[model samples]
Target: MNVLLVGCGRMGGAMARGWNGAHRVLVFDPMAAELPDGAERVDSLDAVEVEGELAVVLAVKPQVFPSIGETLRPLAAQGALFVSIMAGITLTGLGDALGSGRVVRTMPNTPAAIGQGITAAVAGRDVRMGDLATVNGLLEPTGQVVWIDDEAQIDAVTAVSGSGPAYFFRFTEALAKAGAQAGLPPALSMQLARATFTGAAALAGADPAELAELRRQVTSPGGTTAAGIAEMDLNHAIDVIVQAVVDAAAARSRELAG
Candidate 1:
C-alpha cells in the first residue's frame, strides 16, 4: 500500500519504519531525519506529488493541524484513506477537513516507537469494511489494534491507554524513590522498579486471569504486598485518583476536539 505519512516524529517515524520496505511511504516533515530506504521524505506538504487514492497517515502534532488543514483537503478529496494517530482530533473534525468520511482516528501511545504500543481506532460512519481492514493492517505493525464500536469511547481509550504509559512510568518512579528511601542503592532501586513493571505487564498480557486476581496471588494474606495495598487503597484513594485523572483527560479531549 502507498501511504502518505504527515509528521515523522516518534509515532510517525515508527509507523514509517514499520512500512518502509513493505510499501511505498511518503513522509512530510521538516524535522524528520534518517528515514529507511524505499521511503520518500519532503519538508512541506505542498511538495507531495503522489496522485490517486492513497492511505494517508495523519501524525502531525495537534497544534500544527489548524495551520495546515487546508493543504490536506485536496488529498482527502482524492479518496485517500485518512488514518490519523493524533490525539484530540475527532473523526467528525477530520472528516470536515478532509471532505471525506473515510477517516480513521487512532490513539497510539509512546510504546509504539518500539512496536509494543496498543492503538485504538474509530472510523467515521461512511467508512466501509475494506477501509477498516486497510487501516487495521496499516496500524497493526506498530502494535495491537483495537477497533472501537462507538466514537464516544475514544476519549476513554485516550485516557486509559493513550495517557496510560506516563502513569505507569510515574508509578515506577515513585516505587524507585520509595525503595531508595528504604536504603536500597539508587540504581538497584530503579532496576528493580523497572524490571518489576515490565515483568508484571508481560504477565498481565499472557495470563487470562483478572488483573485483580493476579494481584491477589502476589499479595498473600497480611503480607508485605497486602500492607502496601492497604496503604494505597486507604479510603479507596488510589481508585479515586485514577478516576479523577481519567475523567480530567477525557474532558480535555472533548474540549480540544471541539
Candidate 2:
C-alpha cells in the first residue's frame, strides 16, 4: 500500500513510523522539521504521484484542511481511500471537501504516540467494505480500531477516549495533591500516585474480570479502599462529575464540527 500522509506532526509522525517498511509513505508537511525513517517527504502535493493502491491519510489540523483539501481531489479521483484522524472533522465534511465519499473519519487519542491508543472510526455513506478493511489495516499499527455505524456517535467518542487521557492525568494530579495534604512529601506523593494509577491500568488491561468485580476484589468490608470509595461515591459525586465532564466535552466537539 502507498500512503500519502498529509501532516508529519506527532500523530502523523507516529503513523509514518508504524507504516515504515510495510508500505511506501510520502509525507507533505511544510512545518515538519524531520520525518521518520522509510517515509519520503514531498515538497508539494503537486509532486506526489503513486502508481498502485493508495490511501491518503489526513493527519493535518482541521483548520489546515480547508486550504489544502481541494488540492487532494485529484487523488480522490484516482480512487484513493481517505482516512482522517482529525478530531471533529465529520465524514460528510470530508466528502464535501474532497469530492469523494470513500472517506473514513477517525478519532485517535494521545496514547497513540506510544502505540497503546484506541481509535473510533465511522465511514462515509459510499464507502465499501473493502475500503473499510483497508482502513482497519492502516490503523491497526497505532492500536485498536473500532468501527461505529452512526457518525453522530463520534462526538461521544471524541469526548470519551479522545479526551480521556487528560482526565486520567488530572485525577492522578489530584490524587497526588491529596496524598501530600495527608502528610506525605509532595514529590513522593506524586511518584506513588503515578505508579499506582499506571499499575492499575496495566492490571485492568491484563485481567479479564469485570471492572465492578475487580473493585469488589479490592474492597473487603470496612477496608480502607472501601472507605475511600464510599467517600468518593457520597451523594453520587464522582458519577455526577464524570457525567458532566463527558457531556461538556461532547457538546464542545459538536460545536467544533459545526
TM-scores, each model vs. reference: 0.93, 0.98
CA shift of 163, model 1, Å: 0.4
Q: In candidate 2, which residue ranges exceed 4 Å CA deviation?
A: none
Candidate 2 lDDT by residue in tens digits, 11-31: 989988999998999999989
Model 1 per-residue lDDT tens digits across residues 77-156: 67778888888888878888778898889988889888999999888867878898888788877889998889898889
Best by TM-score: 2
Model 1 RMSD in angstroms: 1.7
Error of 1 at 239 (Å): 1.3
Q: What is the lDDT of residue 124 in candidate 1?
A: 85
Each model's lDDT comes to 0.86, 0.93
